[model samples]
Target: MLDSPLSARLEASERILVAGAGGGFDVYAGLPLALALRDQGKEVHLANLSFSRLESLDIDAWLDEDVAVIGPDTASRDWYFPERALARWLDAQGLPATVYAFPKVGVRPLRAAYARLIGRLGVDTIVLVDGGTDILMRGDEAGLGTPVEDMASLAAVHGLDLREKIVACLGFGVDAYHGVNHVQVLENLAALERDGAYLGAFSLSRATKPGALYLDAVAHARSEMPDYPSIVNGSIAAAVRGEFGDVRFTARTRGSELFINPLMALYFAVDLDGLARRSLYLERIEDTVLARQVAAVIAAYRDEIRPRPPKAFPH
Candidate 1:
């Protein structure tokens, strides 16, 4: 089962819902996973913040064939559909679904609606993607930068404690504004206590092929590369053991900077792997050390914010 492909994970879930910010990234990542679930006879729902100005597009044509080429308007950046619309659509469906959110998702009412979805599902897992991790770490554009506080609020509203929750941290991609990157933040994971609930991190490593690497080739062409970060396989192997113990915390093992929606799908894929190993539950409280680490980083950033002395002392 360790060598089983993503299809296996999708097949295992009775019902699945893929959610993320709409964009090329999501189409590339999340859509494939949702289609995989559908292929396996599992009820699947795909939801995202809209980014198309086409009013509405045909979903069937987009996923007509394996690795199909979707039209431009299906995920154009100019469009910004509200999350509430997706939530309403899901509520109407009346089926089990997992809502995934990415970094800097500030649509408050959408999140609230998702919390209600948790109650509706009763027994379901909520996967917070790498982008959401960014929001959790740096707070939002409004300067409300407390992840612990936010999680606490969500827990209270949902009547669930995070420490007991299966919180899977998708630990790849170097995109600072949306993904976890700072070394200090990564180091602090050692202190986190998800109670007995599983808290795991994953990072992909570059592949060893017979030719120049893809990232190197892109760099030579001066083309933009995706934000996903890479590490030595040994390092990832070690971190996996350290964080998850005997449990396997799966990573793509393919070096790719993932876009928003796909990143959410990857979160579910890995979470499914962990779930297969052992059942993970939500605890009322996570480790207090998370608070200490947050304070330390905030203080470090605060120091950076300190006013500097005048170039020359005043007379």
Candidate 2:
């Protein structure tokens, strides 16, 4: 039997922070991992790069200039707030209700905010969770789906001087809507494996407790925000429940055909430092103060490079 490095890494840490790399319900994708860690007597916390307007939050809601503490009652005007909805679900389930939220700012402030949260929570380990594998893309990929926020989170966490730092990406092909090529995603993973940064992959099984809870949490979140359910998580949840091939739940997938297959339940893990080092453009945005600046840096890099032509997965 192969010993799992991902399990060993989690076992080595006492205080862990599992954060959503991309905004929205990306953090929900971490629910299973976080729950597993907690069951092992590790103190785990949840957070996200928020899609909600943090500015709308009352001054008291802020943990600092960049981090906000969002509980069940936290106020927000947005129709879609995955953080608060997740909080409510947690509260109802008798778990911790507070979900930390950070503005989708540039590397500079986002890094600072991450540092503050680590200090406040006394976190020794950080697991940056990306709902999709786009975070694994090196700049030259034919389609790096919505890399802005994902890269921002990766770059920001890379700046942290933590003892244990890892990244876990779920919902494999869910980023297709944003144009991520799965072939390029696999190629990047192989490269990371060469660098010894690939932590190994695991799949979620709805038959287990963590997997069942993940399905419940995702369903509860979707129920809480019926008007704007998360397509990424919805598809992941559907796949986890053993659904496949264009299975639709919400109207979010009305037109597009979806392949809700077993692969979507798989998680590809990697070490944050090696992953960050592999990035061709993260250094360019390290000094940025605004989120748009990070986007600009990526755009400039993309313009300068000749991306590999998109390749279809040859079955």
Candidate 3:
């Protein structure tokens, strides 16, 4: 189970946040994993910034069925229920958590409100998926009357110290149709970090050859420093390839060809909910006992699986 090398740091976080850009459908991908963690008795939360495409989907139907409406036009209903229902479901599962989907509010109040809530809740770890807001914030370097650094700045502003906290990133190949590819996304992320020590990430459903190359790279790198947080790759490939005991990494189809973004997205959400609630950690070095149990099941098929390369389609 330790073979897949998911981040060990994540197991130690209690407060978490799953964040991503608005256009991609990764959030929908994350829902089922979040639900599963609830079944395993972990607290989790889901957060999508306001104006995210995720907010425009059919919240009512998704809550009822946990389905994703990949395109904005497929189904229409009040999108509020999914967020509310997710919260209600968490409570029902004996996990105390909330889901916050932010809207495209004017810069001023949105920053203030975000900081206030984080402060009130005392968040710990933040799971960022294909999000550039952290880097964008750094490029702008304008403070929101709250000390903002990087994406981690959000937590810092709310008085959440991340020096000892964990941040999990299931960063992977983005939808070929939505945004930059996986490599480009990581290239940008590398530019944003000063020390690579705290970052942990994993890949999902990339083209087969590249996925294998990436898996090999991350695995070799992480095994060397077993103490550093694990950066997982290939798990998405494993999940999709059915190497991990029929468990799914994605619950819904992504706008991309592979339709594998949701599993990674929801996994981040479940982890964040646990982090935000302080249920993901155990002794702060080892991952929270609750999270490790799940990762154990998830990490098993590292060798048994391989992703099928995406097929070329006629233009």
Candidate 4:
């Protein structure tokens, strides 16, 4: 007696883990979902495929051979520690306070690290959250839009033995900078629905508490690191503020005008098991131990496969 597939899977889950599939600010995309789910009284943990230098962290910070516990107090000479930055913001808001960070590694080590984290947290549900829709690409897209880290998270978590694993992408129309085609993105989602992997899509409203908090978090992150503000969140924030096409926000998009449309505010979800089953090349990098190795494997597979023609929005 489940109202929806996502609810049915999440029904028995007591502790949930929301992780960023891609490195960098991708974890910020999970803020709204994490906040909304927290409102339902579920215990949630946040983690990320971090672009930070985990090797530089002190031994005490290491939770496992591959994972590190990042907090607001965590210090680094490196300017790009998204995990610590997020932890700081969470602390300022008196939220969960600690964010777990996994190094940008391949499927083998990444999977091992994820298994350890799952064991430590006793997590019943693992949600792979992506900042953009690129994670939906099924290996035959004309462009995969920086698939390395996203696919690594996908393959790594796919190898885990878990009751419920889901993928929820928050920001849409943001990966176009990396040449992702949204028409093909829709086509892949339709195919996943046929395979029973598509979990349905929802939009984030700025009026909601979670959405308002998310907007605040994104704004705070931008203020903390103005030079490297997230284009994805900027677009999503603009859409939430009721902006329309071709609106300008950051200097990065000065030459290339952005389409600040509503789609950027939506979250498209799918079943991890079904999505893994549909992958044409995930198996190729299963044994990879380095990020470069994973990239090489995907490149070779794309070279061998006949890619689907890129489609454009007909409207």
Model 2: per-residue Cα lDDT at residue 141: 88
**Candidate 1 per-residue C-alpha lDDT over 37-61 given as tens digits, one digit per residue, 9 for 90 to 100:** 4556756554343233422334442
Report every candidate's CA lDDT. Answer: 0.31, 0.91, 0.35, 0.89
Candidate 3 Cα lDDT to native: 0.35
**Candidate 2 residue pairs in backbone clash:** none
Q: Answer with 2 or 3, whichever has the higher lDDT.
A: 2
Off by over 4 Å in 1: 1-13, 21-41, 49-108, 115-123, 131-171, 177-181, 199-315
lDDT of 3 by residue, 11-38 (tens): 5556555443231222323443344333
In Å, residue 293's CA in model 4 sits off its true spot by 0.4
Model 3 stretches with alpha carbons more than 4 Å out: 1-8, 19-43, 52-97, 130-171, 186-194, 202-315
By TM-score rank, best first, the candidates go 2, 4, 3, 1
Per-residue CA lDDT of model 4 for 1-315, tens digit only, reads 436677777878889999999999989999888887787889999999999888888899999889899999987777888788789899998897889999999999999999999999999899999999999988888899999999999999998988899999977888888989889999989999999899988779989998898889888888878888888888888888889999877787878868888888988999998888888999989999999999999999988989888887889
Predicted model with the maximum TM-score: 2
Higher-scoring candidate on TM-score, 1 or 2: 2
For model 4, the stretches where C-alpha displacement exceeds 4 angstroms are 1-3
User: Between candidates 1 and 2, which one is better according to lDDT?
Assistant: 2
Error of 2 at 210 (Å): 1.1
TM-score: model 3 vs. ground truth = 0.41
| lDDT, candidate 2, 201-267, per-residue tens | 9899998888999999988987898988888888889999889999989996789999899999999
lDDT of 1: 0.31
